[model samples]
Target chain A: MSQPQPTVLILEDNPGDFFLVKEFLKRTSLPAYEIHHTERVADAIKLLQEQEFHLILMDLFLPDSEGIQTFMKIYPLAKQAPVIVLTGLVDEEVTLGTLQQGAQDYLIKGEYDEKLLEKTIRYSVERKHNQELIMRSEEVSRKKLEALVQERTRELEEAIKKEKLLVDLKNQFVAIASHEFRTPLSTIRFAAEYLHDYLEKIDEAEIRSKLKKIEKQVTHMTALLEDVIMAGRTDLKKILVVKSKIELRNLVDKIIEDVQNSTRNTHQIELNYNVNSKEIDTDEKLFRNIFINLLTNAIKYSPGKESVLLNIKEETGLLIITVTDQGIGISEEDQVKLFEAFQRGTNAASIAGTGLGLSIVKKAVELLKGSIRLQSGLNEGTTVEVRLPVATTENKPA
Target chain B: MTTRILLIEDTEDLGENIRDVLRMEGFNVVWARNGKIGLDTYHEITPDLIVTDIIMPLMNGLEVVREVRAFEKQTGVSPIPIIILSAKATPEDHAEGLAAGANIYLKKPCSIDNLMNAVRSLIAN
Candidate 1:
């Protein structure tokens, strides 16, 4: 088989030594090779920069450079090529030093024959090629390890953030729960104690009023518990969206009636229904809770306002219900976190509330594939608009 | 002269119950619905003792205490004994209430006996 001509650069200052090395290379029984000759290190470096060679045969003592320094200058420019040191004397220490500093092999003058020189050149080229292969693979593995470490660090940071959010939510829940429960409990305790200590002094009418206050407190506590349980159910994804055909107007009327009865009908709620089709396929229980919460909130927040407006209409394929109150409105800061559990408006702090009403309403609306919007300013008024897509004929239960 | 007490609380039922109990104890009790009104009533009546709830609209109990302290400092009158009744039961909350110049901090739902004792002791002192 024929072999490609191997290019060689010979850097030697002495003309006689260069001729003898060239003669030895020509005598070797190998394939034809190309040789480049330069006397000074500067000219050799220029040639090394311009052209790539298969092997570099360098003399230790050049006109511009001497000893190990000569190899150091040329070694960087050698690139992938193997460098063989050619020395006049057989100094064991100097030869070992050059070898340690990445010199492929060292040849002595008047000692090595053509055969030894040929073998040395072949072995050095092969060893250098193998070393380059090992280095390239090591580089690839190092990059891969770095990328994997960065990805793991990102995932750990995300997990820590989620853990911190859960802890914050837990703390907020504890504070709200403790505060809400204690107020009513205190009232019950005070009323019971007052009656027990002053039973004879207080008449039957006063006794009945004290007992009634206890009952009212117990009812308030029960309602608070129910709100907590409902919130938990929604959080745990336990509430299922069961869509069925129902009269939307009737459902809303029933809800309004219940709210008015509970609130003692203090405020007049004017309902305006403007829809041709009253039937809608939706989760009845979720729908009831959503409007119940909205209507109750409208009445509760509008303390002195005599009336609230509930407008229901259909736009495109969506059913839009808006409950507007002409009472103390929510501030921009409070409105931002209005849907978050246990968040209450700063102005509404004095009002009695579990602060779970709006969050629960939001979750219920989300489950029904709807959206809610609120518009209000501090002390102006609040209007809550909920848009829910009416299920088409295909989605209707058979 | 009656041992007059100024009671500050937001909840109607709870406020009424406390007022009735204090009235039954023979102390002339004046109830204010919030911290702002409570502070105003404190100046008007100059009651023997002040019992205030911590969380209320217009102003919080701490602010009222600070304002009352500042007023007393300026007027050179003897500071009225103050007690804080609140649902905030955390150690940090207690520290804050006392630090705000309240004579005593009582968590909500405290026994009526405990409350009467505290009120009597502060008034007596």
Candidate 2:
């Protein structure tokens, strides 16, 4: 491969000094130096801008400019070129100023020799190549650092947004709970007052029935409120699960009874408990919430007169509870997002809820090593099947 | 026949309302503001039915259910039906209450009719 020649740009107003540099560089034994000579500062500036030279021979006093000002003007343009000043008029102050403005070496033109010029040209070219390498590396490092800073800034912004969203959600929950609680509590209050005001004059059986209804409602309202609070606590990771041996059949029966009594929509629940009289070791508290959420969803979604079915069986070392509801079913698209936090189905929007029921159910089920699958479409009814490992094996870490 | 009920609740308004309603129904009702007081009164009176709310100031409803169950286990006394009244009526809450030895759990926003049905059914069972 042909080697590239070292290019030297000479900026000297004196033709005698320019000829001396060219003659010295040409006769030198070093690699061929491509000499570019310019006698005026403007032509030098134009030459520096057009081509990249390895070395520049600068004269302190030029025809158009003088001193540090000329060096300052041309130094920026000679970014990759190493500068050597060749001036006949030399003083300590001028020498210091030239060297400070990036001149590699200074020589008095009257004292210039062929040997000295060749050595200066070779040394300045090598030094310029090394400086270029360092500047290139610094530019790369600067770009990488800027990119890293931008990435970290984006991550921090997202975290702050999430935190703000959580705060807003909590505030909304508090407001909704407070507002909702008043209506139920007021009903209980009015019922109690009616019973108390006409206690003596009211028919004994009628008064007793009204009071019984009032008592039941107050209890119901209290339970619902407590559930909302507990759901919040679970979301905050404050609720603890207490594990024990629980009869599956009895658990299903209890859930059926609660759902039947809670919602008076006349939705009958059919239970199919195929598992033998075997008690499974699990956290009953967590299980109850899962069942309650599932059963409530079944009743709420099923058409008023339709029946809700519960099928419980053991398979593959797991206890499976499948709840089927014949109410307004979930669309295919909604099924994908059903278990995510704050995700509500389009059809279920008109129904009263905090949109946390399914999310809480999924969390509780996962805690119990249970997997839930839904089968449904709009108006097709829904069947939610949950499979949970009977004994959470202590041998394996969760 | 006037049936006596023991109510365990933490909130003053809820407790008063429950007490007044039961009294209106011509059934004798005793109110305990917290689970501890309810447990004490349950042992003292042994009412026909026990209605309690979970999440109280001291000795929550879950503890009260456990206490009542322990008392029944020690003595061969007739099992008193305990109903849990709570606002936290997630299926998990129902399972928890039942696991804690509650006979039944009713969620809030429940109708008076449903509550009465639950009370009557539990009493019958």
Candidate 3:
């Protein structure tokens, strides 16, 4: 079977030149081609708009356009079609200028043979096709690079914003630490000073009360320091979950006992245990930290209230504990940032606190692969629920 | 008559200690737990001197000092001596306290002896 014909557009005004180019194309060893002829540049543009062509033979000096301008006019309309200029020997200089302006090749009117014409058209089309492919690939790669740069810029902006937030948090922590420590230190100093100055004049009961105040202040300071250290450890991701077998009921009872004694039995702590198995495998240290912080917070916030409650139960493969209090509860706005380090409720300003308790509890719960939820309202009360998977041999930390 | 002083503080233990020490020194002391209550007591009793904490609920020490000064200005009463006790110990904090009309700015954990001396001298003036 024969190859399909190549379509050609001839934009030469001279009939003699157009006939010569057509005859040369036929006589060449090229495949048969369809020819579309036009005498003026405008007519040639209209023909190009209507149909595509494999090649174009243009004359630099047409009736409506001339020289390099004629080639420029047709060049944009040529699209991917290769364009070769036809010129007389006298217009050699102008023809070379058309070549520079993207006319593929130029043939002198009578000096060129059919073989030369065939070779020129073949090479021009091939070269133009290769140039277009290179341009298209370059465009694709340039767009890909632009998208990559945009993505990197967005990532860099996010990192900068995070860095600024961390710096702000550090400054806030310093300010809070100074104030929290000073309040207790002031109390301790005054109590000690009073005891020294009035040792001989004060009664035994007064002496005991002053000493108790000093001890209490010292304990308060120690707890604050421990919270700061624990927060630092968790922020650094240095804590490891160490699972061990523990009696859950006894452990919780002991924590409640400790909290009650420390508060001097200021509030009653009722514990309700409904779990079937008292024995469980878990990280004892993390569990203790979680409950201690929760219970202490519940009692501390609920001044003048009678009691707080601790409830524990078990679901399939899950252990759930809830601590409820009838305290001055948290507002909705405060609860949003309650678990952030060094954040305190607006109502808590009158109450003494480092605002680190719930944050510490959150980190401990996360380490245990557990989830904590808080329900609270202004003056209504607060209930914190924690759920954890019961650690078995298969799911235990490696 | 015993010299009367108003002590404004929020921390329970510290406030109690200050009140006790002042009483031991033979000055009649009235304690208020926050700035609002302190201001109300200031109006009711018109104590001979005022001691206030900087950070508190309802109002702050600076606002208290400004209000007292404004009251003195309005009523043509003699300006009352005011001492500011604060945990913020920076030079800027001291300037801010004094600028707010406090006669003295003392950092927290200040020596009890120094506080007494300041109280005695300000009363004498």
What's the DockQ for every one of the candidates? 0.42, 0.03, 0.35
Question: How would the docking of model 1 be graded?
Answer: acceptable
How many residue pairs clash (N, CA or C atoms closer than 3 angstroms) in each of the candidate models, in the order given?
0, 32, 0
Q: Over the stretch A56-161, how does candidate 3's per-residue lDDT look in tens digits?
A: 9988788999878988899988989999988888988888888788888888888898999999999998999998999999999999999999999999999899
lDDT of 2 by residue, B17-52 (tens): 667666755668999877778889987988999888
**C-alpha lDDT values of all predictions:** 0.87, 0.76, 0.87
Model 1: per-residue Cα lDDT at residue A285: 86
Candidate 1's fnat? 0.67
Cα lDDT tens digits for candidate 1, B1-125: 89999999978899999999888888999999878898999999998998999876567788899999999999999998999999988999999999999999999998889899999899788
Off by over 4 Å in 3: A1-6, A27-32, A49-52, A90-93, A188-226, A229-238, A392-398, B1-107, B122-125
Best by DockQ: 1
Worst 10 residues of 1 chain B by lDDT: B54-63
TM-score, every prediction: 0.70, 0.62, 0.78
Q: Chain A structural similarity (TM-score) per candidate?
A: 0.74, 0.75, 0.85
Q: Residue by residue across B57-112, what tens digits does model 3's lDDT show?
A: 55677888999999999999999899998887779989999999999999888878
TM-score, candidate 3, is: 0.78
Question: What's the lDDT for candidate 3?
Answer: 0.87
